[model samples]
Target: QPRHSKRQPEWHQRDQDELVVNQPESATLDESQKPAYADQDSGSNKRKTRGIQQENAKDTVVLSKEISEDSKLAADKAMEAMGANILTELKEVQTNLKKQITDQSGLITKEMSEFRKEMGKRLDDIVADLKDVKNRVEEAEQRITEVEEFNMDVKDVLSHTLQLQEDLQTRLTDLEARSRRNNIRIHGVTKGEEGDNLQKFIENFIKTELSLTDTTLGIQRCHRPLGPKPPSGSNPRSIVIHFLEYTMKELVLRSAWGKKVIQLKEKRVFFDQDFPSDILAKRKAYNPIRKILKEKGLRFQTMYPSRLRVFYQNGPVIYNSAQDVSDDMRKRNMFEAAGKPTEDASQPKPGAFSWEGASGIQRWTRETRVKHIQEKLRAFKHNDNTL
Candidate 1:
């Protein structure tokens, strides 16, 4: 019977779902603390243990009291030990959970730092690109300004050269007529003095405009006549404009100043005010003045545009004489003057007649033309009386 009743074969361990189902709050307290309705069957286990202990007592009433005291002390000790074990388990679980939270916080901090650094690098690259663009824009603006100044200079040169051409033509005619009266040609009437004066004027203009030091511009000129054989030494001269792009470089002849080249110094400031390019653009839509300006240097001299046919194309002097001055006469004049006459196919033939439009007749507008009239009007400005 004792073998069969041995704890009923421990039903909590054998043939059971022994996994931790619930850590109930009630399980924290002792099962013995409950009263079980104060009934005999309900409290049988505790009562049986007490009665067996009492029967095993072998001393008198005083001895039995001492033994019951010892039993109560042992039960109190067991309960205290169980409470300590439960507290230790709770502390271990709490420590592990706190460690996990700290590790997660560290990982998040590291990721955030890496992301911040990456963003900073990208922003730096963007700022550098913006700086480069700004520099290019500044450079482009500077180049445009240089081109504008060069264009203005070309305009002035064209006007001045035209005036010179007219003056030379008028003087040549007077000299030729005087020589004809004598029936003997007057030689040695070269334009050396005038050519030097024109070159000096160019240098002074550049100096005045730039206010620069160590700057010098040299110009040379020669002239020729366009006609049949007039004489061996009667060809006109040309006014050549030359400059040095750099100090050590070869002299650059500025035959035709185009807008595509000419840049400002590296450190100079850009244009302080807007240029006339915008106005030119508008005018060019209906009237391409630029084309005329480029094609024709300056059709000067006569009151009508048709007279422009008598001017030089590439040379300074245009020899417009009476018809029948054959090629033999022109060659003789070219040699007497010791000048080589270059034939320009673009020039009009001798005695060729044609109807020229507004481009042929209009001199400078009335306003700009006044300067020419005034030069002749001024007394004592020149020794000659061509006016």
Candidate 2:
């Protein structure tokens, strides 16, 4: 409820009036004109400031472009100056490198030439030395070959000489065997013709012993003769024994009067010497034993005591003969035994059969005349079952 009266305070009123300032109409118009003037002045000042800024901007742009151009020009000039200096230094270094290469090439060429000359001299000397060595070796090899050939020749000669000697020895052996023509030999490991020879000796010994008729043994109580013939048939008979090689034979002979035992070979021997009974150079044997037996009164002519005469030798006993071998006529007096004349031949004195005849037999048994005949047949025809 506010009243519009004049009783209000003067300040309130004054505030209102001042806020709504009530002046004369002309004065109000005049104040409004003053603001227009101030606005024009501000507008003018702003335009002037804007114009100055545009001019400063244009000037700064022009100066920046000019400085950029100047800096480019300076850089181009510096590049040109550095290029000339670098070219000059490069030329100087190229000249120095060429001189050094030339100097090194010359030194290497000179060294190569010297080395070639030295090597050529050394190679020539080596080649000459090798040639001399090869020549000497060839000469030595030739000498060695000659020596080898000579040694082979000497060996061949010695071999030929040895073969000749062997041939000669073989020939000598053949000649010795040929000289004895059908002549009987009495020898062997223990007996030879001596085998049959010893047989005859035994018979002769028996005949002498039994002919005494003084022994208590009966005439038929002994062994018989191994001869091919009978003891008696009213005729003289011969006993043949052919032993061309080894004769390991034995004979048992006898008669009604006595017994004859003959051992042809008991040991082996040569034609010129006695028999050997062992594998020794020499040894005591039966001959010595026989000698001792004779000393003890045992009668064995082959022993040293019996002293057999060749005239009565029934075996080819190696004994002294009763006749004189020097006198040819007296030596062959066989006819004188039967009261007949003696005959002679124009043969040499040593070529007589003085070594043969009489009853050349040895007996080991005494059998009847008929029995003796049967035994010979038995020996010849009888088959030995033991074989």
The prediction achieving the highest lDDT against the true structure is 2
Q: What residue runs in model 1 are displaced by over 4 Å at the alpha carbon?
A: 1-115, 177-387
Query: What TM-score do all the candidates reach, one by one?
Result: 0.21, 0.33
Q: Model 2, 1-387: lDDT tens per residue?
A: 122222444544564465355433333554556654665655775686587557556655665566667667777888888898898999998999989989989999999999999999999999999999899899999998998688657545545554564476446534543432222222222212324454455335434533633432222211222434433433222232232322211111123212423222332222221221110111122333334334444343432222332223343333322122213223545334333222212112322332323587433222123234444444433333223
Local distance difference test values of all predictions, in order: 0.41, 0.42
- In angstroms, give how far residue 74 of model 2 lies from its true place: 3.1
| Cα RMSD for candidates in order | 29.9, 30.9
Clashes of each: 32, 37
